[model samples]
Target: MIRKLLLILFGMGCVALQGQLAYEGVVLDADTGTPIPFVNIGIVDRGVGTISNENGEFLLEFRPREVQQGDIVRISSLGYIPRKIPVSLLNDDVLKLIIRLQPNPVSLEEVVLTDKEYVEVEDEVGYRDLLGKGIGYWKDSVALGGELASKIRVRKGLRRLNTLFFNVLHNPSDSVRLRVNIYEPADKWGAPGKNLNESGRSILHVLRSHEILTVIDLKPYNIWVRDDFIVSLELLGVFGTENISLSLPAGNLPGVPSHRRYTSQGSWERIDDSAVGFWLQSTFYTDKPRKANKPRQLRKREKKEREISGTVFEIISSGRSEMRSRRRGATISNYTSNKSVKTDEWGRFRIKAVKGDILGVSYPGMYQVLTKVEEISFYNFQLYPVKN
Candidate 1:
């Protein structure tokens, strides 16, 4: 009986080893045959994923029980067509592949422009020590085509943009390349809308530490923004494989109100918890009246007007008794104006908001609720606990 048990144990071990799957591959550009780094590879709907290394090489491992026979593996990269393959087709326990990705075709739109000299319309300057975390593509999974965007409110129509300048704290030891993209705001939520720039290949070079002020010239590109727009910085590539651990420094500025926002999952969101703001400045030429061209003065006056006319609204939360303790820090944010406030210990909060503004209520373990501000004040919110 002991000899038979040992034989069965050995047989099970061999079967387990045979069930293990190891996949190795290199991602390359189909046209140039050059390796594409930081490609995102994953099993569809399985939540198992990995990124290719700097050399475009990747290894994916699956335990006997983790993978299904028909599970599909997906490979995707920015500006490249994504590819998918089935697990059953990979016959060998240890399989190798050289996957090629085709570059996505990009059409350049014609930019209409009237000749104009760019003037500094708006500026936000207050750079403290680097705030290690602001917002950007910092992880390998979202590194390719990863973007961070800042919302800039423009009161008047603009003829052309001159330049955008911002400071970056570079990792002096490593070299990195970044792309700058500009877009029109999609809606009141501050998401990126249409690509305003003709070419998305604008690159910035990071050389030294001590707050390198990178400038992006927009004159040659003929980009124009009428009202408000978003400026985004995209992480393109890190120079060497050894420098994979290094990330682009987050732009830091002294705390300013309602001007900072970022995106990591393709949707823009505000940065509220901290006082530091992302360092971003824009210079452009506006064709509107001189009064409309004075953004800083206009903003100040508008803020004062809002304060005078703004209505104070109270929010109340009613939910399950189990979730009452978790609703104290619920946040009330105005999506249109970017103003935010928090609920108090009693789940009550007051905010000065104007009509036509969209308000969102969010809590840690509750479903977020959005309501449009009307002409009245004193609003009550019903908070519901999130279903697991």
Candidate 2:
């Protein structure tokens, strides 16, 4: 009976699922008639989805009670046209349906080169520090082609990316294959739009057992863009149970927001305004960035933001700039008062903490620290950057 259920779950048996609906199919190229692997197949925003494996086969099962009216299965892939089939029509078809996706490749026009004044500049940008624990399907099996992307700001003029770096955070699988994609901002919403990778070949990387940090060389692809763009990593295949996450704790890296799309051709959904946790090595022929707003002097700032009736602990950097980078917005939690406050530019924060109250401080790139309030005169706090 267990073997029979397995066959039914994989769409091999004729018996229909009791309380679930399963869509099984093999996605193929319409022109070449070859199996198209890693195709996205699922209903929009329903969280009911699956991706075609390397052989172009997939099985997507969902509870029929969970689907709302007008929901359709969206089948999509990079450089291919998307197809939608209504939920009611899927049950009418025979099991193991064959899907053909037409190629709708967008062309990149050739342009003539001209000599112009150019400044060659390069810098590294991304959320390298562990601000939070981890983001994504923290510890669960996820469909193939599920992507987690972060928006990266670039300078004016053309920018070329050479290296892309991100952390796995948690991967229960022994190995997981991933694809790197760089996209121009979508016109209507400024979300991840057109695929900027000119090469027809997919940019692929493999994370082996015990490996955490991943760095991919993008110099060969010659990826160049003028405006800000999004960098995303797509799940291709997992050797074991598919459990992974890219999010971190800390809640720092405020400006960059992360974006997510469940499967190939699915709609892009903004996960949160929080960090995306991916950075890159950027080279551009553009002028320096505009000067930022002048920072308010730390001492001159008004302390009247809140009334503090307890000891004031100054979080000083232990000769590391990482401590200062997160100084202004670092989180200071007063477990005693059941309240929290952000640190000022000088890494100083005042909270209501009496004797024996526990205080926890968090900053990017530094280990989280907790202190038990002692004598008022001995409240000196110092922190160092976290080592890799």
Candidate 3:
């Protein structure tokens, strides 16, 4: 049964500030005509996200001027192709607002092996440390409807991912729904981009009781990856009280910098106020042993010698050089590209620069200094405390 989403325009009724409207809709399977549960409904990178209820119904509130002609609301779900709707189509007073999604099943990859025997390796790696405190969302701060992602560096080649492990820093809610998503490193700034989990099945987990550590099996998906990837724990919904957080210790092995963003499409700010730690561990099987990360001190020396050819960019896939190159580093946010980098204490940083790029040097309390890229390859910045 094919159905068009029925939307009725309220046209700034009652307490109208430009145009007041309420949006309520239901998601259904295009072929089955049955309600789909837990469908992700949100504006792309706009920091707006919500999930359909068990009844396959959802309601999201939007402020005036929030919707534009080209803006779209994305509906993403497991075992279905993502759907997008234009903002101009939204309205109110519709009884049967039906949105249908088509199924998208991922084709499993066939494995081929040669007779040559090599090595089989199993490894569990991530920041798996339990300390006194962690990032407490909803409780410590407001529940931002987005994901908190941390970069997880892995070796190059194929690895059969086994389980994803995360430490629950705190969970005051009786129950909550969480989604695990894996992402490929973006080509532009190396931020989390392009969903890598091609299984077409949502890795959903429900928490009944609070446990210090939670492990999710990845073997069922048969996921394999090379180079570096990102793991994010997304908050789907909160049952009972609004208290849920994926926690890690205060800091990593040290010198590792952390960045925070509210929405998938929101702007990223450096977590420079304090060294907040974020670590996600995963176990995987491979045919070769993992390469040991070079010591930071050694990598630093090699960097000063410019042996890495500046590596072009400081963010390396191995992440061994991430902290080695970012300790006491100044954060350089590329306003033009929305990418950020940090200059080491020696006042050195690297970014893919082009002409007319507006770069801002910022700190938590100080005013930001914006510098336009000309023919210069170096810049110096000093921040003073904001006036009271």
* RMSD over all Cα atoms, model 3: 19.4
Model 3 alpha-carbon drift over 4 Å, by segment: 1-20, 92-96, 108-113, 130-145, 243-247, 250-388
Give lDDT tens digits, candidate 1, residues 41-79. 766555455567669987665574766888877777656
For model 3, which pairs clash?
45-265
Task: Say which candidate scores most in lDDT.
Answer: 2
Q: Which candidate is the best by TM-score?
A: 2
TM-score of each: 0.43, 0.62, 0.61
**If the candidates were sorted by their TM-score against the true structure, best first, what order would they fall in?**
2, 3, 1
For every candidate in turn, the CA RMSD to the true structure comes to 20.3, 15.2, 19.4
Name the regions of candidate 1 deviating beyond 4 angstroms: 1-24, 31-97, 108-149, 156-162, 168-188, 191-204, 207-212, 216-227, 232-287, 290-388
Worst 10 residues of 3 by lDDT: 306-315
lDDT by residue for model 3 (262-373), tens: 5433434444323333332233334443333433533543344311102112222343533223324556765433446866665566775565445566556655555557
TM-score between candidate 3 and the true structure: 0.61
Per-residue lDDT for 212-258 in model 2, tens only?
55556687787888878888888777786646643323233556566
